[model samples]
Target: MKTVLVTGANGFIGRNLVATLSRREDVEVMRIDSKNSLEELAEYALKADFIYHLAGVNRPENTEEFITGNLGYTQYLINILSSNQKKTPILLSSSIQAEQDNPYGSSKRAAEEAVFAYGHNVGVNTFVYRLPNVFGKWSKPNYNSVIATWCHNISREIPIQVNNPDAEVTLVYIDDVIETFIGSMDDPDASYISDYHDISRSFKVKLKDIEACLVSFKSSRHTLVISDLKNDFERFLYSTYLSYLPENDFGYDLEMKHDNRGWLAEFIKTEHSGQVFISRTKPGITRGNHWHHTKVEKFLVIEGEAVVKFRQIEGEETLEYPVNGLSLRVIDIPPGYTHSITNIGTTDVITLFWANELFNPEKPDTYYLEV
Candidate 1:
């Protein structure tokens, strides 16, 4: 079995990395967190086939801790590995700030030098990743990532401060980073010696655009409108935004149009495709005695019993299909066909509806007809 050692196993990226590695059948993981002793770290480092040195201090009280945590800890790890005469491949998660001259950057630069020097002296493989702003679930709010802060505040209805709306940020999702890191472990061709690597898939988004996208995600519940999920950036951001929602707020009530007949609520709507909605029909009630020119629809009875009747606009014969919650079946209402559904059972019927186009009151394609 391949033994992998991960430092800072309790941090955001470290937690995610450990969870991912735990699922592998052929890998054994050694997690070393801040509470672990140096003896424990050394022991794990000696036995590890690969070392992921993710431990670092980004928000320390003093500048000395940056050196101690980032630089000193790396030197300590190298000492342990060198003493054991083990040439294990080491992967270091560095930051984009290393190019700057700040204290954090200076310490990171020193750590990078240590890793590169150790690889040179011991003739081992080492990889360093200069990562951008990494954001995703499990990220701590009010820390290094603006995305995390925005998501946390917005989910709680708290106000967020944006100093520079025009400023753009380069963001790499944690999942993408983890995926690339794991792939590097498996694919030797993807890694090189003493060179800085970057996550292949990253997005550059403006601050204002990020806020707008997140706000749209929040408003989607009442509007029943789904953003264009086909775009990769929006899709990832939307997923990340949803992860920050409060646990108690998992379920939201949809606006239902009520009438003496029954009630209908739109569930989800897309820009190009139609919309999905659900409705309840009173017992012995018939609805949708209409035909469409271009729009088509689908009906599926989720609860109770319903008989769906359809007839071609030019034909006199009516077709009927009985559906219920037991054996869920869907009936398609084609264009140029007059269709209607009647609740035949003793109880109210629950049906799911899908249309090919969003209902436009101005140009309603529907015409009154009898089926």
Candidate 2:
């Protein structure tokens, strides 16, 4: 079996990579972190078929620690591997800050040079990824990534500070980074050295846009409105935001309106696409004997038995469709067609309803009629 060694195995990227590698049966993984000694890392280097040099410190208390942790430790790893005459391919996770003139940037740049020189001397493969801001579930908050800090704070209803809302950031999701790292291992030529590799799909978004989207997600609970999920950046940001919510806060109760017949609750509503609501009808009770001018709807019975009756506004013939929990069917209510659903079973019937437009209190498009 191929042996893989990962440095900084407990850090954000390291933990995620190790978790992924552990699930594969073809390779054995050696995780190295602050808990492990240099001797232990050296021992693993001798046996490792591949090395992922991901250990680095971006948020150290002392400025000198950046050099010791990022540059010194990387040089130490290269020395150990070179001493043992091991020419295994090493993948290093560098950052976009390496191009800047700060201390942390200089250390990262020095580490990249050291890894490149080692590959040239030993004729081994080396890959340096100058990754952008990465955000996901397991990232540490208030340390390195602003995205993590914002998501964590907003999830708990804490206030966030934004210095420049107009500033744009290029972000790469952690899953995509991991996928690219894994794909490099499957390459046939492992001895080819590279200066830097860019993640293929990075999103450039303004700070204000991100905050607005996240705020909308928070307001969705009360407003029952959903963001435009069709946008890729919005979709990814929404997923990441939800990942930061406290476990107990996962489920929220929708406001259910009660009537003599039963109850109805709006699940989600969108600006352009419309809304979804659910209702319960008691046995022998009927609901919705109405026709719409421009609003179209769909009805789905998920429990008990329901008979959906529809009649054309201009015709006398009425069509009925029987639906039940066992064999659920969606009945579409076309515009200009009067429709009604009756609970024909012994138990209360549960029906899910979808409409083409959000319900406007001022201008309701519904017209009462008998079907």
Candidate 3:
């Protein structure tokens, strides 16, 4: 079994990575944070086949402050790993800025140097991946990610400013990033044996074109000091392989995330009259797989006969009842009952139930059966 240690595991990128790793059958993902680094880091490295170094100062107010936070902390990590003599393959999560010159980029480069320099002497197999503007499901909301910020603002009708009209940046979806990370597992082709892999995404999209996409949503003509950009989408197409270039990379699919207008239309039709609620029992399914604590539920069987069984946690008392009433056999089930119902009717049965209070959407409040 492959086990991997993921540092900064609670972060925006780390959380998503953790989820992806958890879904893998061959890998066990262990999470580590810097607060517990002294005790956890060494133990984690010893347990795992790989260490993904993602903990660093990706965000800070000033260049000097950011560099100090990033460089100093990574040096600590490198020293610890080097001294431990743990030859685990170290995969460092770097940003495009590491090779660029903004405060963030510079700090990333400095951090990369720490890893690279250490790798040279220790013979530790180190890999650094530079993430471009990554976006998709579970996107982190921060000022720098203009694509998400702008989309969210437009969705909410909030005002947003656009600048650097044509500042080109590359973007890859979370899924593609996952693919790239997994692809790294494959042996490098004979053509490339360079120690440093410039794994930067091939996509280069002009910022203005992304803005141009939002023209339909623009209520009125608003302008920010931006250069007008026109792109030839066909130029980036590659015959053999899918291009990671921006022109080839499609933007986010909106339908994947929300259905606001449809939900709102339904909302407008709903009114507080005769207490409208929702209830469903799956065909060949049961009710009260567990009962509630605060819900004042009235289960009125509307169709075929059904069996309802429950047990009180307070006593060794268990109760079974046959409910076949078209109307008033509606049983008022109080809370603190562990229960389950099995559909025994010849045909699919239906039960209409309503509560005095809204169902607590959280599932932890209910108890279940062992079976």
Task: State each model's CA lDDT, in order.
Answer: 0.91, 0.91, 0.59
In the range 1-371, model 1's lDDT, one tens digit per residue, is: 99999999999899989999999998999999999999999999999999999999999998899999999999999999998889988999999999999999999999999999998889888889999999888889999889889998988889999999999999998999999888778875644668888898999999999999888888888788878777788888888889899999989998899997799999999888889999999998998999999898999999999899999999999999999989999898889999999999999999999998888899999999999
Q: What lDDT score is found at residue 360 in candidate 1?
A: 89
lDDT of 2 by residue, 153-226 (tens): 88889999999999999999888888888877767865567568877689999999889888889889889998
lDDT of 3 at 304: 67
The alpha-carbon RMSD values of the candidates against the true structure, listed in the order shown, are: 1.8, 1.3, 18.0
| TM-score sort, best first | 2, 1, 3
The C-alpha TM-scores of every prediction are: 0.94, 0.97, 0.54
Alpha-carbon lDDT of model 2: 0.91
What is the lDDT, from 0 to 100, of the residue 197 in candidate 1? 83
Cα misplacement distance, residue 265 of candidate 2 (Å) = 0.7
How many residue pairs in model 1 have overlapping backbones? 0
Error of 1 at 278 (Å): 0.7
The candidates, ranked best first by lDDT, are 1, 2, 3
